[model samples]
Target chain A: MRVIVRTVSELCITAGTLIVLFVAYVLFWTGVKADNEMHDQIDQLQRQWSASATVHPTTKASATAAAPAKPAAYHYGKPFAIMYIPRFGFTWNKPVLEGTGTDVLKKGLAHYARTAQLGQVGNFAVAGHRRTYGDPFLDFPKLRKGDAIVLTDGTTWFTYRIDKGPYKTVPTDVEVIDPVPRKSGYTRPGRYLTLTTCDPEWGHSHRLIVWAHLDSTQPVETGRPKALRR
Target chain B: MYGWIWRHLPGNAWVRALLSLVLVLAVVYVLFQYVFPWAEPLLPFNDVTVDNQ
Candidate 1:
């Protein structure tokens, strides 16, 4: 009878260990799988957008003109495409939205505030979660200075490279669009991209900022690398 | 002792191994088949409308 108890105790310990290990394995894979699946979906959406982007004869002419060209209308599969530090493997399809909704933000896309119009010249920005639900933006910190960000309208793809920051977070305010950081001599009248995420993964005490200036634009179909004229 | 564990072990080890396999299979089936799909609705971003560009 004592031997029976000892055997049972040993069995219980072994079973418990196996169970714990199985659960850990499942959870870890769950997160990893979710992240991969999310990126896959975003990549698919991007490819579809690129395939269907409108190519206009107006492109070559616009490139020659001094005036800034406007982006095509917001479309799914057609939000601005960004290729970040490929080293960080940052790629996402940020669908332009007129407002932030659970529907819009879930697919690794940005939801524009309703009041904000799509593709407007001033401080056009979008937001996403730092964690959970295939949180692709979870590692915005991994981005470094001089990293590239590309936004496209099917016909023309704009490239921007990170300028500076790991800067202090600012409150959501109009000043974010002043065409320059206030009180700084950094003002320039050209296209730019501003990326934001929660300061720390779990906390929102501050916001992390990444800013980049227009590097160049290219025709997706033409596949020619046209450097942005500064 | 190690030799005894590997060669002289009782049928209980096999039984426990089988039981562990079954438990893992069942848990995985439930998780992938039902729990994940059910929990997907809890994600902040889900329905994305792609506008024609």
Candidate 2:
């Protein structure tokens, strides 16, 4: 009788163990599915907006001669999401937060509190990771002066072309936020985009900077392809 | 029957304990797998995306 009782207990336990493992796997799969679905939807939206873009992405299109009129809605505090970066092939449909802390970086897009807004008439600044944890800016090193960095606030997509430097070892010098980075008293050019990322991944000893001037700011109705805006 | 086989197969106490833990996890997982869907509201950050634009 005693032996029979022990055997029954073991069988029951084994059955329970199998069930738990299955549940864990299911939960994990569910989360992955949700994330992927959201990402796909955002990409589809970008395609619809950028259908007219004529250039093969890897090569810069001959400098676009036409630039769109600055949108009147360009405001200082409104949020924007990063629809995609063709140069680096990063497509994030998620809402972009303005800061680069662990949580915001984990999502996508950091607002670059130091730079100017897309239509603000100054250098719009933002930063992100170059590597580690789905690093969107990993290939930023390859971008050239004319490559486009697209930003959107869902209603419009703003394109900015690469303008300059992969600045190195520039201490966090909050002064970089002072309209002009690294240099003092130099008059900077028109509306620009400044993107910064940590170099080498393992160490934050240096900063990698990429600058771009506004190419065009297109509203959702202005024929901007959806694939370029999420 | 399968129950008879389970009752007779003897394993060390540690082994049995490990197996018991595995069993418990499996049962709990199954319960959660079916039960969690009904409790989505209680989960953290279900609507992670917000249109701040």
Q: Report interface Cα RMSD per prediction.
A: 10.8, 11.9
Tell me the tens digit of each residue's lDDT in model 2 across A1-230.
Answer: 97788778877987786566545534454445445543553565456335533333322223233443443442233334554567665443343445444445444556654456554676666765454334556676677766767766544567776657655444455454455554423266566666667655534556667666667765544556543544
lDDT of each: 0.51, 0.53
- How good is model 2 by TM-score? 0.53
TM-score (chain B) for candidate 1 is: 0.61
Q: Which ten residues in a row have the lowest lDDT in candidate 2 chain B?
A: B44-53
Second chain TM-score, each model: 0.61, 0.48
For lDDT, the strongest prediction is: 2
